[model samples]
Target: MPPSNRPIHARPQAMRNFRNEMRSATMSELTMPVAASPGRLDEAIAAFSRAIGPEHVHTDDATLAEFSDPYSPSSWDDYRPPVVLQPATVEEIQAIVRIANEYTVSLWTNSQGRNNAYGGSSPRMPGTVVVNLRRMNRVLEVNDELGYVVVEPGVSFNDLYAYVREHGHDVWIDVPDLGWGSVLGNTMDHGFGYTRYGDHAAAQCGMEVVLANGELLRTGLGALGAGDGWHVSKRGFGPSADGIFMQSNFGIVTKIGLWVMRRPDFYIYGFITVPQPDDIAALVEALRPLLLDGTIPNQPEVFNDFAALAEGAKKADVWPNPGRVPAEVLDGFRKKSGAGAWNLRFALYGREEIVDVNLAAVRSAIAHIPGSTVNGQKLRGDDREAIEALGQPGQVQAGVPSMSFLSVMDWVGAKKPGHVCLSSIAPLRGADVLKIRDIVRDACAEYGYDYGTGITLSPRHLTHISTLFYDAEDPVAVRSAYDFCREVIVKAREAGFAEYRAHIDFMDHVADQFDWNNHALLRFNETLKDALDPNGILAPGKSGIWPKRLRVK
Candidate 1:
């Protein structure tokens, strides 16, 4: 039977039934892992069910659909897992891992499975059973004195924030634009938020991992059984193994200790805008000194007018053009909306007098940019009413959790809108910023797509987040978006830049670009993978580090 013609998101009762039928058919014909036969797969599933009750083992269409990537450039079928396991306890996870090893069935792991644009909960290798840890969601400890919290993989930003507030803790969580994702998961993936602790990986102090052999290991201070200062210290007596687990397939991270910001006595949310498109270079230049000099404590984000406009409006409603929207149209919209060609948002946290000094320094630094303007609001850290009134962007920068940024996905005006971000890191220089911008813009133009890009400024570098928005229901658009992303990545690489992270389809492509010393880094990673997971039962092809058996050679 042919697949339904209805939109992916517009699923009626009939469409749901069609999906159920498709899932049932696919399950019956499910492909087993390379090392496992049908009997072995069945045995593995049965073992997993026994380890963590059958109620927690999901094989139905409804549950599997939740794990599939919604914004995949290719069909989700290409990356879907055959089964999923939900384990609540570390012992259960260990049992599941042992069973997988025994059966030689590969396993993919996720926390809340909310890393949507980067493939969500989907596995890089098809047929790998997903071990989702959402059931392990727990705020194990919140130490107000030390300004840190220990959490399980399934503890999300919202969960942590609510826990802090409910307990009247004085610490704030650094949340990304969307707050539905797991805190430990985001940190493990090197994801960033918008506060002083925006560098999530750096903010992480400790980890508890379950290795492929079902060995429980703790990194940093946690390695000492006492657990004293585990959440506060980032280093142990020996080498720090925490960095290796990030963005790697070596182990499954079950728990993490993250540093949170203590509530500032005063907070100021600020916006800087420039009237010309090229003004972004100057804006970046002006802000660099402030960041380096510690005048700006948090990561500030600069959005092109298109990106700023996307947050609230749709492209079809504004331009209705076949190609890129005209500059005049964008300019007119900016004027009507009282926005600028480039908009920068930042935050200041300190004592009232110190924050005022920093605010003055920030204003003075950007004062030279022609037609530039700055404005903001000040609030006490305890003023919940004022913080709530500050809205999404302000609230996000202030270490508050919000899902409002999800609206940007709908800018393409598709019933099932989607986007894949192509991010590249460059030095915090105006010339470098402009170089990346031009490369990305040219690639979008060549592919006949609108340019949607933003630059996030860290202390020493800039993260260029270029989005390719498209209609997920349209296969042609999906392919085009993927093609555009690939081209942009190559262009950026040739221009002496590389992506900090990548979607599952592009992980190998991105990893291949790191060819220093005949790919010695990759070789080293493969060595680790082989030593840790001999049977290759863990996620293979993750970050392009295939196990010995799965290596192309």
Candidate 2:
């Protein structure tokens, strides 16, 4: 395959020079050593094709373009691999792992590869074979009686949702904003959903993993020779190793056990709109108790004006040109669209009477804030609208998944659009949300971009996801968005907040920030990577945990 650098577009020479200088000083390109010879790389691809099938091994130009992330900051060439391999079963994965180890060919695993914002299906470094598991799509078990379902890496949220509904089970699975991603992939990536089971990591119970050396193992109670409760039991009699696999490249996850919720009796969905920018403090103070006390037992979202614009109003509806909207214009859009300055969406579950009491408590909590209006509609489990609403974006917080969230991509330029998202953990205090908003608002302004923010209430903390949107066809827009987001990551860290996740292009930079006691966290993860994968054949640069043999310089 031919090589290429970042896609360039017309921009000021001064700006390009400045960017190059800054990148050279701060972030230098790292090397994932190329294969010793073209013959070896060709041999590995042919061997993988023999192991899987000629049809399963994808290396055509069209397939390579499809594998490239259209929305990432750099050129598609930067993340392009020579081939993509599809495995249908655990046995096939094991065989491929053995072959990869034999050839020392790096493998990057992606579930559904629909994680568009954080680098869709792209490898952290180029030349690694993409192990896409879309063919292993299966709902192994949906045990309503046990309230847990087992699925493969390719089982998307939509797949699981359809399976459970068709099987006539009264179960709901938590999903992220977009429901096209894999159930196993989302959980392993620590993605967020808004439900009692919203925290995907917490909802995971068991895992089946294929190690680097072609060995198979199970985590949690499955570690036992005999166990009837592998899905429900999180801890085995001895050491539970499930936590180590999530977000790490030590192994390829074949199957995962997810705990979906039983259908609730009543559902109340609504939003509290605050008209003031500073009102985020009051909103946080109000919602923290309801969450901690279990009054509202689901993931509640606090979205600013831009989230509403991107989701409901859309950029095409307001500003066709790129740049931050004026404060007054944003306020007008929110008021017209019924999305206020800070819209707090809350959902209450359980019995009808209990929901009412909790609703009253929530109402009283925010009753003191001025210019705040509450709007909501309650639905019964059997209500037609409730069932119809299952296909909507915000319903994921209600334990239902939908692909409607992808509509946000079109807000900027719809035609082959791309975005970068950075998620950071914030203190639960009302003041912290304000600090977060200010940091992002200013950072975006520096680049003449919109400041999109969402504050999600976890039981005890706030996970704030800030997004930067751009059009893939516009190279200048792409670089600006990527460069600006990198600056925001550094600024937020200086303010004592660190992002939980980032795009593939920026993973190494983010990983470098865990400098407490001289980057002990990364050091420990490297030790595990070396011990688990000495040949460095599995996702060598994933999440910045590099294997010793393939360590980037």
Candidate 2 segments exceeding 4 Å error: 1-32, 35-37, 73-75, 312-317, 320-322, 390-394
Itemize residue pairs with steric clashes in candidate 2: 194-397, 309-314
Candidate 1 per-residue lDDT, tens place, 161-196, comes to: 899889888988899998999999898888999999
* TM-scores of all candidate predictions against the true structure: 0.93, 0.92
In order, what lDDT does every prediction score?
A: 0.83, 0.78
What are the per-model numbers of colliding residue pairs? 0, 2
State the lDDT of candidate 2 residue by residue for 1-553, as single tens digits. 1112321111122224544644434122333345323576788888888888889999898787777786853354667777888889898899889988877788889888766777788777667788999999999998878788999999988888788878888877787777788999888888878778888889999899999999999888788768578899898877778988988899999999988888788878867889888999898888888788899898888888878777744675677655677787887787687777888877888889988888888888889999898765677865635655655634776666776777777777556778888788888888887787788888777778777888888767898888787777677777667677778888889888888877777676677676786678888888898899988778866777777765522
The runs of at least 3 residues in candidate 1 whose Cα sits more than 4 Å from the true structure, single-residue gaps closed, are 1-37, 73-76
Candidate 2 worst ten-residue window by lDDT? 1-10
Q: What TM-score does model 1 achieve against the real structure?
A: 0.93
